[model samples]
Target: VEEAKRAGAKVVVVLATQREADEGRVGRQIADELGVGVVYLHGIQFSGGDEYCEYIKYTLAALVAALEASSGAAGGNGLWPLLILALSIAVVAEAGLLARGWWRGGGRA
Candidate 1:
């Protein structure tokens, strides 16, 4: 963990128990000692299968939240949504033109 930190890597610890996550004992110590983020499995077990899927979802969400909180990079500068809207409008217009041409017997023999 310390080596990773020294290498400029973001460290996050995932514990398997609620007490470690909520009580702020083991998790807190680890977080403070290594300056890392800590997330617990909460209601789900760490075993493989369906529980593993849930853990993956939870871990991804936690990671995204941590990144957003730390750097605000995920929020963007508000231009992406506008670009997406413009792309959607352009697609809709193209589709409309195709539909209109089809309706007017564009492929007539």
Candidate 2:
């Protein structure tokens, strides 16, 4: 993990299961020491091949989201802008709904 990170690789620690007698303490310890993203697959290790594929898909999505969030927190990026836009749209939609409800109630309440 350290070597990979030194070579400019974004490292993410993945644990196959947390059901060990040590309760995955070793994997968690390494991840903590390295300050890397750790994904615990839980019982998926005992699942079929299809579940493994699903795990890959979701893990990739999670990794992308984590990267985006970290980049957004690092500096002035489009993330905050996009978040504000989304919030503004939500507020507008909520206000429209409220106005319609109030109108239906004959301006009461």
Candidate 3:
């Protein structure tokens, strides 16, 4: 985890037990020190195991939100909207061009 964080990857640590969640001593400490995300799924590991899947989804979403917020995207200070709009415009233009070409070809393959 430390090595991955050092390599510029986003790190998320999931604590599987209540004690681990409460303390997460080393994991939480490292996460705090490295500005990473930590999630506590106290019973997912020992319960039905299917709960782990649900918790995994939640954990991933939380991590993404945290990373986005940290990067200023969620704060509206980033270029996210501009980029999305640009991509939308590009897709629309491409679709129009394709439609025009199809019409010119009498809608044939």
Question: What C-alpha lDDT does candidate 2 achieve relative to the native structure?
Answer: 0.55
Give the poorly placed runs of model 1, Cα more than 4 Å off.
16-18, 21-24, 42-55, 72-109
Residue runs of model 2 more than 4 Å from their true location after superposition:
9-11, 19-23, 42-56, 69-109
Clashes of 1: 0
Q: After superposition, how far is residue 48 of candidate 3 from its true place, in Å?
A: 5.7
Candidate 3 residue lDDT tens string, 1-109: 5686767644545555633544577767767777866554443444565443445445445555555655644556554564555456656666776788799999984
TM-score of predicted structure 3: 0.40
lDDT scores of the candidates, listed in order: 0.55, 0.55, 0.58
What is candidate 1's CA lDDT for residue 80? Answer: 55
Q: Predict model 1's lDDT versus the native.
A: 0.55
Clashing pairs in model 3?
A: none
Model 2, TM vs. native: 0.38
Tens-digit lDDT track of model 2 for 2-108: 77557543334454555353546666666566665455543453456544434544544555555454453665655556555555665666677778889999999
- List candidate 3 stretches off by more than 4 Å: 16-23, 41-56, 75-109
